[model samples]
Target: MASDVIVRFDNILALDNFSVSIPRGVVGLLGPNGAGKSTFIKTILGLVEPVSGDIDIVGLDPRKDVMSIRDRVGYMPEHDCLVDSMSGLEMVTYFGRLSGMTKEDSIPRSHEVLDFVGLGEERYRPTASYSTGMKQRVKLAQAIVHDPSILFLDEPTNGMDPLGREEMLELIGKIAASDKSILVSSHILQDMEKVCQYVIIIDNGRSVAQGTMASLLDQDMTKRRMTVRGSPKSLQTFSEQIHRDFEETSISEEFGQMNIVFINDGSFAMILDMAKGHDVQVRSYVPDRLTLEDVFIRSMKRDA
Candidate 1:
């Protein structure tokens, strides 16, 4: 739990009066580029101390129990942190030892975690020649080799093709299914939508929206995701007719449908009548709930 936390880097305030009660689950730390996500992770890990406010991870205070926190918390950083000369198994073992495990314990644990991360055979290969996805697996392997209680994954899908990204997300899903907790920080909202149960949206180095996925995006907005069947031109003209009749703001067309966003005073009854009069097909007319992407936009544009 963190309340009224402020983290500054020199003269700049990286996090501004941040307050959030993050529940234990697959939580995503969502933000735009340079929105203090990395800074927030560092503060939780005790790598960067906050200028003011309180932070308690599990039952321990980060300031006094840095090593204990490090021992139980796993971190997979976004940037490359691999040693070119070492093999994958050796890399994981080294991190395990650093987490207070003896060589005897680390050796087998490294193999088990590497296998769990889909790096079984390649554990003997040098990390220097590994692909981007493989390197990410190595990073993940090392982070969890010590069997930490919670994991922090920063930009788990940074660089990869479509297939690579899918595979990485699948691995993350498997991890999330386990008992261990996870906090993923990323600018990519799609991956977060796929795996996370909760989200904390940040902007301008401040917390904006934080809640469960369904709750945060549950409200219907000004737009409607209306799928219709008709000629493009007729849809356009009918849109104009609706605007003229019901004081609709605009009519935006995509594919075979149109977005009819209007004030609450406006009614979908007009749209139904228009469809009936024109003999056009109305496939579906449902309220448009904000997507995770849309919520991020709203959070950034609106003041915290």
Candidate 2:
């Protein structure tokens, strides 16, 4: 069941029966801009109402149990909302208090959460002076101050350099390691591929694909890819041998490499055997299986 479901604007259906079962570890929401990724998160946060359907958070309706859900779910908003005057420590403590923790509980918990995000000593400094990474850390710390069961982070690594992005990714991994489920939205394909075990791809307000990585890859029905690399002459030589050996094969060549698609296992093995005999170095060999990106593209194309 979807929690925080929504359909906005008469012209646009933000979520069209968009439903997914989330479990522990990181679940990625991948889509291009205006693909309803942001709208989905906002709806789940109870920031927007759905025209139809229901959103249940751990069996409680987000609309009816907004307060309870707010306390149980931690969210790192996409935009910057931190007050410049407030120190990292003060900000986290403030959120903790707002979540129903007493002063005594909030203060110590703030430091712990900041430390967990790798901002221990810097927690006392004003966020105004912090770098983008540090501010992101503070935002993350505040979200987890109350130790929520689930965390929703939207573009957590936005505006970060490569190094900063890596560090933030590691911290997110740690959060997932603590046995809490995480739902993260990001447009960066490579980054999302690193953290999420399950992926949900949306396009034009519809869920194009949703499943585990392996399941998505298995959808293609064929699981074999050939890469012939070396001199262009050798590539051409090897490709001709493959074409002569297999009756049903499709070839796509690019950048001095040949991608051979074989429909049957016999043809796949035949190509490999021939390549070995010719002494051609296969630079890269991967199965032509589907990927999350592939499935996304294929599904969208099918619907179109």
lDDT (C-alpha, whole model) for all candidates: 0.83, 0.79
Error at 188, model 1, angstroms: 2.0
* Model 2 ranges with Cα > 4 A deviation: 3-6, 221-223, 229-266, 269-292
Once model 1 is optimally superposed onto the true structure by TM-score, how far is the C-alpha of residue 78 displaced, in angstroms?
0.5
Model 2, 118-207: lDDT tens per residue?
A: 886777888899988888989898889999988998899988899989988999998899998889998676787778888887777777
lDDT of 1: 0.83
List per-candidate RMSD values in Å: 2.8, 3.9
Q: How accurate locally is residue 296 in candidate 2, as Cα lDDT from 0 to 100?
A: 64
Candidate 1 lDDT trough over 10 residues, lowest sum: 257-266
Top candidate when judged by TM-score against the true structure: 1
lDDT of 1 by residue, 113-172 (tens): 888877868888889989998899899899888888889999898886788788888888
Q: How accurate is candidate 2 locally (lDDT)?
A: 0.79
